[model samples]
Target chain A: MTVLARARRVREALLGGRNQTWHATEALRRGLLLGVGLVVAGVLAHNVVLALLGAPLLAASVLALSTKPSGTPKVTVLPVARTGEAGETALATVRVDPGHGAELLAIRLPDKGNPGPGPVHLLPASVAEIACGLYRRAWGEGVDLRLDHLVAGPDALIVHGPMVGREVSRVLLPPVRELPAGPVPARPAGLVGVHRSRRPGDSTDLRTIRPFQPGDRMRRIDWRVSLRSNDSMPYVRENHAESDADVVLVLDTRFDVAAEIADWSLPARGAAVRPGGSLDTAVRAAASLAASYLRQGDRVGLVDLGRPRLYVRPGAGRRQLLRLRNQLVVCARSAGWSSRPVLNAHQVSGGALVVVLSPFLDDAVVGATVQAARRGNLVLAMDVLPAELVAEPEDRWGEPVRQIITLERRVRLDALRGHGIAVLPWSSAEQGLHVLRPGARRSR
Target chain B: MGRVRGRGVPGWRLRAAVGVVGALIVLVLAVQGVTAVLIGLVGFVAVAAVALPGSPAAMLLIGVSAVATAVLPGEPLRWEVLVLIPLVHLLHLSCALAAILPRGGRLHLAALRAPVRRFAFVQAGAFGLAGLVALLPSDRADPVVEVLGLLGAAGLVLLVAALLRDRDRVG
Candidate 1:
């Protein structure tokens, strides 16, 4: 290749997708202008000190101008995990093959990702690895990071990039706090589980004596009961077997309510569920319940009423729990106010315990919750609405509107309770469970 | 919502350091009367450059201030001017560094070691060259020779700068 052609090829290889121009930085311009300007002025005026003062600028200019960075270095950013927990830190890395004469490399983590314009790192020619730390503060699916890179020549006078970097996603699962998986009514459809089944089988709970059948194991024959019978028929004690139940977590993603009730009138863009908002509370509660039940070896499933497309089938294991958590994040990301809340009969299995988490802001969601109870599934409606609602600043008739909504909510809750569906606020659900447990004292 | 948290070094601290250094240099030269105004203006610009460090205005200020400090007509060569040189250089350097660094970035002292060392070497060479020039036999120069010397330096700077400009297509 000709010299010009060869140089062009080399430049292309080095810069990759970055803008190839070696632009003058503020440092270079300052050095050149001040250095030469002072030197010439000193010579004209016969002032030695002034000329001497300009030497560093001259030296810097010379050093920076000696040679241009030769080739472009391609940076490959590694993919980060799609899911993480709140307060957890995930690590990511970028790799580069050093371009010719490439001296200083800087990578900026975009502000949209986690936060901050990450770190500025100097790369040793041989060491091309750059690691980034991503800290997840709150739950939700968010852009993990977008990389912005700038590569400087040996003296940092000439720079090659401020180029837009690649963007990656990171989903953060809501934190799961320790919560008692309140007493769910016995619906032992599965043969193996943690809940106690009333039927006779191998378990700790003792039941009344019954005649021993042919298939009954000899070890199960209660010698005391058989001898006491004193009849031809042998009597054996029966015990309840440990069985599992199906728990379906029904999330109502129809609306994300902020604490200040007046915000409803404002633009919905800023109307995201705040840290202690209704959706946040519901997500935390659901994660806690899923984790607790799954740990107990019970089957747990997830259903998004707002977006039925994101349903998770009932499963048991650590991996399934991870899927459920990730699915929950997806549900929250697409969560919004829908015209109607959907809870198809097929979503919940027969005799499954359906826990419906909702703010009950719309009449549609209330109807859906009641419909689930009517379908023979035991339903627990978690009132995810904040206890206090603030009046909108712009609305002149705010107080009356607040009172009317409050009255409507109360009536809807009462109607749910009247229909044999358990209606309790999220804050009270755990405590209510503690109260419902047999012989368990209710802690204030 | 777009605000970034967890910065390793606060940006304000870097700006403050640059401002303080620039102000001190200008204050020490305040005795130069009218000349002090020009230096003070440069100092003010330097501080403003903290907020907008990457702009060409900073480079122009550095040049103007250096010339102002040098061209004060009546004053004899003072040693304090020597001290002022490094401080001004540092002000320009710090402002430029602060401007280019990403938000929330901490200074990497090790990465700066080379640049700082190069500057220190140049500074020492400058003082040495000045002392040597002072010791040389004095020759009264005609206006022609002065103009020629100035033109020669300017020509050399331009030539070197042109040569340094990248000729090949940028990637």
Candidate 2:
């Protein structure tokens, strides 16, 4: 058979008779032909028993044809949850208001018949709601589940559609691990925030005890200190003002290398980013840190090192956290190398904690991290490389090649640490940042 | 991609069940002196009916057996015809459904419930008619009844054609 004929046969087997309203099947013809032929032949032979044998099929044909399903079936596809974390299974339902005539429904779903991915499902039309478990393995914005459906009439004698349902595109956010919250370098400007500021104000942290100021509240006075003074000089305690920190999450989208050393050179195949790759790790790490800082009432922002157009300005609140996470998705979606990683000093304030998340595959990112450090910003270089490297099985020299690459990368990371930049690998990202208590990470 | 499937009846199980029914009917017809060629024909057609239900082999399996009963110069009111009537009808009904859902498909048992129920109802009515037919004198040759059966068959074929044609036009 020709390829077209073969495809049509396969399609009919899967999704019965596409795009047409319910019509007769081959069985209908078989029944009518065999039934009438047997009855007529029996009469010609003057045999009453022969005529009786054809009665059942004749009755079946009439019964099947009589069921004329009335209304046009309307199919509605809805995902119970539009957004979910990567690797999470979400439920998507395809509801068919089979109107009057539909008997069977054939929908494309991720089912056993289709061994690879999503494909056809044949079920009774009475089942209006078909809940399919849609799993998105990769991160970022893309189509999660697509329902291509059709309807068949009674006895599967007729069919109505093979219409493609609207694609259930969901924003599969990169999974955010609840990392330990760490203090960011608070910019001296903001007057109210979680961190203690140098300028004395109405925070609970006591800065010092000195002679009572004219504007000091009565609550600030220390009665014990006033009693201790022989000169009758009253002393009041001073508290530091609270300030919010600007956390610029810098993502290096240059190299999205996976753990497999062999696949490192390949562009992302059939996926936005390679699963467990450098870029995937970076996006997840950025989202986690953003959530952590924003939870602590600090201003969080995003800087896409490769594509500057995707930069999210520093803002505080729950919404900023969401925007930062979404921008991280956009970064993953359009991830590629542009001009070398950019981190101009003006992109962030003087004391903003610039957490540069990269795989450390190149010195350019290391140099950018060091440059931000030199610009008086507390820069933390987050190495988001996959923890384990897998060598190609067939290649004899693969292990040596991976070893050489590993040694070079290790030296690069060590160089960044030597420049006073805290190199926090993704595995220990939040843990190492906790050491940057206030002025600890700031060299100047 | 998320793959989902529920508890289902395999297509082969239905085919095999009907194949057994067809085998019984074929064996009953094949027992006319129980020849080797007849036995071979029964075996091949029975397998084809299940393996390729939509193919001409299924039609031949039922058609050849029914024709053999009529042409074998046997008594018209034998116990064999009564048994063949239900078994052959069941095999045909199963093949029709099995053709729609091949081995590649996931067949839910519920999908077959309606068709089977209808088959049972139709079979009940057919048995009632067969019981009535069983009372008729075997020696009687009614010319008027034969003419009426021929006319009814012709009218049915036209009516079926009209229904199918009307459906095709609207579709």
Candidate 3:
């Protein structure tokens, strides 16, 4: 690298990240001093005895000017790890050096899917000591820690800390291949197979056998053995088999509700998973869910129903899961961009399950999800509820306004269910996966 | 920066400059107060000549003494008083100079350490002598004035000690 490039790199490394710079207001300081001096001069001019006092005042002003502070300390953040795992710490070291003396006020670390209890403050210059082992508690079972603010310097020193226990996984789904516009034939490789331990009736292998159970189907009975023994007890068999259903988790990253600042307007809503923003939360949740499904011996993929049309091919293996997670974390989506411009559900293979995780805030994304369901794919829509529903503090406005807003959110959710899509409204009180599901009336 | 071979300024020149400035300040004060200018000038020059042989700053003490005497309310001019002023100035100057410019006699470690010890000892001795003179009952001045004179002498002793300490560190 050239000298300029090296210098720029060094400057960036020292400063931590780009920030606004402030200059000392010397003119203001001088003006205040001049006013005080004038007052003293006026008081001393009354008598000859007091006239000598002006000499000391003049000396003091010159001394103050000569002893002005020289330089201002600055902080800059450098390269940071793009991803981290849940229940594990991600290390982010920042350089904090100052041109002159300064006292560090506070440093704000990103919420690793968990709400931080309080801000951390380091040792002052006079103390000049450092504590090594510091750790933050995990937010939930699978939440990614996100770094937020780092403040350092008046004295130049680099401080390193970890963002502990957060969910960081990548998902890459296969490109959506168009299905032929004709009668579909079952490909031999795509056929859903049954376990072998059970009697052969639509099965390839025999599944396990057990004593007769209440819910055992009669058609699965071995009649020949029953006649020979004149058996009074009937035996039942259990089948453990893998399904051929392909699950495509469509994550909406258009407008995340978790991005808004939590204040008096937003109450102590459970642990904030996406304090960085809603888009980040959606991306993280989608990645986590994709990994979870893939680990269960299922062919899983992802479709970001936002801008740029991020489509990872359906595949199995640890590497494919990582790739998908990486893509989700780094991809950016435009606000007004619609998913309808890219995807159509009729093009998907039969028996595939399309799981759409969205806030359902946009008409285009919602429309695309409905079209996917109509195409014969087992569609499961996981509705990401707006954080504002629970985030809004009840005391901020009168109870009536809060109730109205809650009622309106419910109406929107009901409208989504009306279209025959399973909706899940996320809540802090329960696990996001199990809390909200389609009711009997809505599960068409 | 250009490198010069020897000590930057000659010791005699520094001595002469300090002596001249000291004498001039005393002369100006005497002139402004309408005191006998000849007496003040002679007293200043005598002190300078004696103090210059030792360290330059001794001339400052000599000048201060002249100023004190000039400001004193006394009979204007006496021939005996004029002689005594120069004699006292010469005695103080000789003692101070002797402390700086060592006399060659013994080649012992004690002789080598004598200059520093003598400098401090002579400085203390000069203050004591000045104090004795100021304290003596005199028809010439007030007792309060004598006390002030003693205090000024003590201040001179402190000045000499500070100068000696600085010179010792530099050497």
Candidate 4:
């Protein structure tokens, strides 16, 4: 289906009919009768006496039956956000306009079949407004509202209401996108380097010497080696080039790592992180880097080392990017930190250029990055910190605690660099991922 | 709180309560002799005047009660008694108008207009004059006056029923 059609469907599903009322008509009748009956009884008992009191009661009855109510009120629904990562609050607004002098006694709004009661207020004749917010806990389609006792779902909105009126507006939120595998990067123009060899080919550089089989090419044989050994021998040769690097982007969704800027001087001292939390920043960074690398034709794959592990096998094309983006959005909603680590030693077997995007506030993730690099992968660690952490006042906490945390961060940074892993620190305000390559001459 | 459903009191109960109350009030007034009987007759005619369908029937009942009160014996006609009769008739008329007129739009507007208000005021003034007339002295000592007083008493009972009936139907 078309994007607009799909988006429209999503809107209908999330913000549909939900405005029913429960009026106590019977109770009112009972109260009226009881009051009248008591007065009549008292008059009969000589408890009270009046010249013509009974006349008003008779008149009231006639008037009550003759009056009838007017038309039902007009309502409008507006979806605030759609396609939010799991755990983020999606806000929707419902506006109603009761005709002149009309009074709405009550209103109800529900979520995906679950009922949510709303506050009712007097609207100026022909104008009323109600707002609703829902916390998306799972990934799926469709959301609906409940009015009075009636279930007003997306189908009702689409069928009953005029599609063009100001009554309703449906919004679809697109999912977050991360990295995916693609082609290798092209060699930079005018830069000369030894070409990497997957199999023996025409190459001047000697890559390695190993025991050869019968299929070994004669051209690759070392004649000088045969003379020294005094026996028939062969060599398998290969060359490494700068363009052959593979980038494996690792996105951390662990709780210990604060993905957002710290509101407090200390990260751990703030309120518990909410659902969307800081993971959105990591997802955005991963997507941008993956796009850049894919443009250069470098093989790119994404490893989501969060609670629910997500792996996108190395591939190329616009379709792959879209698929990866969809997955990222779903992951943002569902993934969380767990007791067990998301990545283990066996997952990084085939060496590739690894890019780990995380805040590095957690010890577990820092260890995981170091382990991946030790396995001979070209690992680039992109550390995402909230902008507030850099500007927080030092007096907010004891000087000793601040010194200790900073010292620990420094130690961790040095340890990663010592093990030859590139570490780039990033904040929300930063324009792009900061490059943390080894030497000054080889800056990213 | 428990749910509210249906109309107020059960229909049968409401009808019974109004009927019983009307019967008892009329019975009590009848036992108070000629003056009480005259007042009771006035109450009954007032109720019937408002509740009954025909305005002419109510006007006839009012005339009969007026003549009976004039000729009645047992207690002489007081100034208050004279003033009360017209006042009661006017009240009955007002109730009848309330029943016949529609409650909304132009009818509602007319009900609140100056002419209607003036009419209501005139009826109240007539009733006050009758009450003043009841305070005046009168010399009437015949059995016809007694019989008239008895008929007025009966009319009073019917009027009470009419008033109750009107209330029940409208409510």
DockQ of each: 0.31, 0.30, 0.01, 0.02
Tens digit per residue, CA lDDT, model 4, A113-228: 23223212111122244455664543333343444311111101000121123322122233333433222222221123222434343455556666566877776666666556
lDDT of candidate 2 vs native? Answer: 0.75
Residue B62, candidate 1: alpha-carbon lDDT: 60
Comparing 3 and 4 on DockQ, the stronger one: 4
- Top candidate on TM-score is 1
In candidate 3, residue A203 scores what lDDT? 55
Pitting candidate 2 against candidate 3, the one with the higher lDDT is: 2
Of 1 and 4, the candidate ranking higher by lDDT: 1
Q: Summarize candidate 2's per-residue lDDT along A238-340 as a digit string, tens digits.
A: 8888888888989999789989988887887767788778888888898888888888888888898998888888998988877788788888877885858
Q: Give me the displacement of residue B118 in model 4, in angstroms.
A: 25
TM-scores vs. true structure, each candidate: 0.80, 0.77, 0.38, 0.43
| lDDT scores in order | 0.70, 0.75, 0.41, 0.43
Quote model 2's TM-score.
0.77
Q: What is residue B101's positional error in candidate 2, in angstroms? A: 5.3
Q: What TM value does chain A in model 2 reach? A: 0.80
TM-score of candidate 3 on Cα atoms, chains taken together: 0.38
Tell me the alpha-carbon RMSD of every candidate.
5.9, 6.6, 22.4, 19.1
B140, model 3: CA deviation in Å? 22
CAPRI classification of candidate 2: acceptable
Candidate 4 CAPRI grade: incorrect
Which regions in candidate 3 have their CA more than 4 angstroms from the true location?
A1-82, A85-245, A257-285, A317-322, A331-336, A339-342, A345-349, A361-363, A386-421, A427-444, B1-171
lDDT of 2 at A192: 81
